[model samples]
Target: MATSVDKMSTDTQAESIYFLNAGAAQAEQDRLNRQHRLFDDMMQNDLLPPHVASALSALKTPPKILEVATGTAVWLTEVAKTLPLDAEFVGLDYDTTKFPSSLPPNITLRQADMFKPFSGDLLGKFDVVNVRLIIFALKEGQGTDLLLTSVEPPSQAWFRFQDINWRFAKKVGRDMNLPLSMVAYIKEAGCVDCDDKAYPGNSQLYTRGREDWISRTNVHVKALAEQSLRGITSLGGVEGMTTQKEVDELLACFDKEFEDRIVHYLFVRAWGRKPEAD
Candidate 1:
């Protein structure tokens, strides 16, 4: 029998990945709903500053906003609270588990599947639609994400074996984001403005901000390398499809990828608007 982590990672099949869009949103969601308000302000940092802010300042007033895949709905809602009181806000997602009944009146939460063709009354709407990491969410639980970091020597051996297959997937582009498709989908829905950029966040449990981004990211790099190892072992063992040597090769490759980031670290923060007519 597989452990819980093993079960979570293996339980993810293609079909079930349909409803498994919980992305980095998990961290954000937990932050938003945590019993303390500290997480909301624990920026130790900043917001869409410099580049994005320049564009944001040019936007028309009280524009309508849609935050797709609104998990905890905290990020958008909190930001909305600081908006020009009249700004129209909407949060769209399939799961409403934490949808709050009490929120600023201007903020509206809607249950809509953006993947489908939006019609009639709602066809062409929304001024700003901020979709962050929605692609990673497309297929959640797709693999057996075992974490052998804490496992004993034997399981560690299995983890080392699993890293091989994952390396193969990354090489071809299974990790690529569908920028054009998403842009067209929003455009067809009547959003006139669009921009695609990936600024994967740099997080460090004890460190903070641009100054500490590298240290935080170093931790992340290690974590990713470790994950690749565990994932390879668990998935390949059930089928006898991978070897320990291949796993080491993949781990070494991934470790190098992360090591290079130690000196230079940045994140992508992108957004676009729907022309007023839309």
Candidate 2:
């Protein structure tokens, strides 16, 4: 019966963080919602892990779920559909502009910075806390940025994009490799049964039985590339990519690489359970 984020303020704190792909444009929000669906499909349409889902269902009271950096609340809203009607869903983010005006009756959206502690009432309250694709929000030394890796052979154009993305991330101080370290961070936080699963982008045409994943990956990559370029150019641009013409030319090359089946990246999901009170 406790509220999700009772005392947390609802003011935007956009300037407090450095996010390379940050945007509140409708196009950006649409891209994020599309990416959310792609990720849900990649995980086989399950919002939470099997065990977690089972635990939440078995709870006697209405379960509390919190999603950090929840853009558009697409994932949370979808998860809400599968749970009890009274189950509570809370979404926290620094920017409220992207938050949807209409959410499920059981859901609440709040403005909060992840770097800061939540109000005392929120501590030890959530039945599940979900954070995804938060690499852009981290600061230097908080995480590392590494080049993309794939099982398939990369094309020259793919490599070029990798180099560009690396340089752009460096210039903007965004961490791209934090996903690789999430399980370690979870274990360090004293969470039990920590584990992670990796989903490959699988843009390879020869990968049978994954046609859907291939299509989704390609679409997600293209949209993300465009969004990143928009963000970069808005920042007065990164080296070798300071103009709209340059961004377009690079995107064309990236499209060719995707069409030729020459690009892929691993997406990892890590989770752990907090120790219960004795």
Candidate 3:
């Protein structure tokens, strides 16, 4: 009786790798989160995919769904509402407190550490496991920054990001791991027939006048570097890698890079199935 978190759990090594290497990268990930929010727009525009909607509509017993790090359920609530009864959903995170209290009845949110193995008691089993935005935990040598097809021009934002994210990760002595691996991790935990998707994000559409993703994220990256380095040095945790002035320098460097072009956005989605008899 393994739980969903058992396989996809984020241990201290993983978290440490992310914070250590990514402690310098801020704007990129957060900005990406702000965009392509399908769930956020679901209630308003019925933006969910036709197949997902259809699948949900047919559910007699709500399909059991698991969402990892469901930030605000900006998507979960809509997913739950769109689905038929018996479509049970469980969202987990260390910060489950961030979940909105207005959650639908079919949806259950819990606060738990996902880094460990699963338990049959708490997590029944899942039909579809939805994982988003857990890339920060991958240490390195994962995949390229991200792979996505887009309609945008030759800004090559995605390629540049691949460099930056890996660059920073290497700096912290971590190998970049792709998010898709977590899906395999799920399968090894007894999930059957895992599914994964990497798609283009809605950033280009929303970023028309906002500048290409690289430029946009560059500013945020620089800011994040400055903030994190300053904080680290002030309290000084890992080592001397981060310091007030060092962070400031990193900010300026990123600012200059942003002024140039280095980093972009892409869409990615992955899912897997869990057996009921487990």
Candidate 4:
């Protein structure tokens, strides 16, 4: 399908001022794919929550799914493998450059900004929609919203890095507490049974027998920090991080901390159902 470009809304430019570089490079794609795996594992490997699965099963025809801000389209492609062959999937992102060259026959990836209203053809066109990790690009009122480091104690690095990120986020007018606001957004959108759940990304690091989980979590998080360095530095660097050298040094410290410590955070999922047509 062809990509669609809508006319710019007055707030469009502000909404599009993402803190990270939206480039499509092999390394970024690899990191995103691995990140998806890590998050999927954290969520107990269920592509859809039980209730969502039940809802889809009730449909008379094969269900259609949409994933927003679908960088690399990894999740859509993975979930497609679990569903019936005829079930359709669509993935949308502001930048389609990172979408994989190959996809399941049932999947289509398109370029479109989520902050803008979707085209008429895409409106109300799917049975289910998925959005993940789009918080960094959101503004204060938007329903969606990370950082870490190692010099000093790992805890210090973790919280300090978060502080710097919060400052940067405030400067850019983006909300840092996306999970807290999601249910409200859902309710405002007139959806029913709105709720959110948080998944801990501990990867079993604190569990004695889960050394493999620890190793994988460490590797995944470090890749996250490495990928974020350029984007953070590009925004003129946060306080105490005004130069690329400073950010690099901090990242090295974070790497050391990740190597020695059990680092984890929360991944939240929110959902609501639109009332059936009268």
Candidate 5:
């Protein structure tokens, strides 16, 4: 399929798109893979529910699966391994630099900006569509709303929502947050039987270590802070909230305050199904 950048009303609007950098490309790729593993372990090795899995597996024809912002396509690749031989898997992202050089025969990777409309062929053509960790990238609710509108409603769609919830910790501190606006967005997009479950971040596989875990967790948190700063500044700069330099200083303070403070996050997995046609 032909994937291209989304159209903007003004050139300035088009030039301001920002992607949070987690160090170099390789580091970012590694982070994403680790993230996938963490979530997989947390979810008991099942990405989706048994009902959803059964739905896709029972399809007479080859089921088509689409993953949005599929960085490194790690989640898609793993899910592909459990599917039928004829299953077709597609992963889309704005940058393909991290996509595996070699992919399974059933899997396809494409470079596509999530901010824009999906290619016509991709509209309403998936049995399942998966999206994760995208809240920090788009402006407030813009990204989730846009993504929901762009994709053709599949038989099922699942979203993994993330937020830094310091309230769960014993210590008081600032944390990056994701609001519950996505629940409404899913319903507004005509999804039915919507449901969600929340999980603690520390419950993931990465948190199951001793001294080594502390060191690795520190690195992960620092990278996340940097990424969050970039996202906030990029969107805020467009809206005249703050400049990049100011964001840098504010993030430095945030880092200090966060030091030794109990870190906690909440991830919510939500799913819904499109109504069958009459």
Candidate 6:
């Protein structure tokens, strides 16, 4: 269950000024929610391992969880169902428009920028801080750097692996310039027991409705690619590296590659725990 925090309505002007497209925000949120659902289903409906949940459940007091850049707060709400009744969950996002109208009493939504430093009260308050799929919004190393300095002791941080292969991106005609490894950043942040695991997807994972899932995923990917293309010229400020016509051609190529099952995507999750004071 989740609870809504008392906060002002989303600032439409700020959102429009800050985001690439305000309208696309909702679409992206829907796509991300679907992706989270797919991951959970693929992992047998367990968001984390039995041991992780057990460790959190054993805390003397209710665990306080924070999710940075929590688009739609889908992950927090889903995981909250498995935790103790008193466990508190907070989903922080810069934009509040996508937050649900109602939430479980234990869950709260906060509108905050993840790029900025956390307030003193927020430092080290959470048992777990979760982040996922904000790579497109972040520059290389920016997200990981913020997490490293912001979280407090006894807190665990988790980040989903994003493929930042600039070479492969250049071949596809999209220049994202992402970092080499987010997991490495976590280790640099002084978190103990940092670990990551990758999950490769194939045709068999879809099982009952493989074609349908693929069709939907393809649509989502196409939309994301389109958005990324638009940002290429705008956000990257790379003048004349590729024309709009070239981007269209590349997108077409991507669609065909995906349909032909020649393109594969990998999903990875990394986690680390902060050591208690000396």
Candidate 6 segments exceeding 4 Å error: 1-22, 141-180, 203-206, 230-262
List clashing residue pairs in candidate 5: 124-152
Candidate 1 lDDT tens digits, 62-165: 66667876766776776675557887778876555456767888887765555545435454566556664354344322212212122221333334433433
Runs of candidate 3 with Cα error greater than 4 angstroms are: 1-16, 20-33, 36-53, 84-87, 96-107, 118-120, 139-175, 180-195, 201-241, 253-265, 275-278
Query: Model 2, 220-265: lDDT tens per residue?
Result: 6677777777666766666787888988998897677665243456
| Total backbone collisions, model 1 | 12
TM-score of 3: 0.58
Q: Is candidate 4 or candidate 6 better by lDDT?
A: 4
What are the C-alpha RMSDs, in order, of all predicted structures? 10.1, 4.7, 7.4, 3.6, 10.0, 9.9
lDDT, candidate 3, 1-278, per-residue tens: 24544443334334444342233234433533444343233223443444555665676655777777665655666677666666788887654334565767788877655555555655656655666655654444332234432223333333343444445555555534455465666666776666655544344435443455544444544444444444334433243343456555555554554454433344444544455663
| Model 2 pairs in collision | none
Question: lDDT of each model, Cα atoms only?
Answer: 0.47, 0.72, 0.50, 0.73, 0.61, 0.60
In model 5, the Cα lDDT at residue 237 comes to: 37
Mark the 10 consecutive residues where model 3 has the least summed lDDT. Answer: 143-152
Please state the error at residue 227 of candidate 3 in Å: 7.4
Q: How accurate is candidate 2 locally (lDDT)?
A: 0.72
TM-score of 5: 0.69
Task: Provide the lDDT at 154 for model 5.
Answer: 19
Q: List ranges where model 2 is wrong by over 4 Å.
A: 1-24, 144-146, 149-157, 203-213, 255-257, 260-262
Give the TM-score (vs. native) of candidate 6.
Answer: 0.70
Q: Pick the candidate with the highest TM-score.
A: 4
Sort by TM-score, best first: 4, 2, 6, 5, 3, 1
- Scanning candidate 5 in windows of ten residues, the lowest lDDT window is 154-163
For model 5, residues 23-129, the per-residue Cα lDDT tens digits are 36776787778767656765767787768999988898898999998989998988988887789999998766678889889999876777778999999899999
TM-score of 4: 0.87
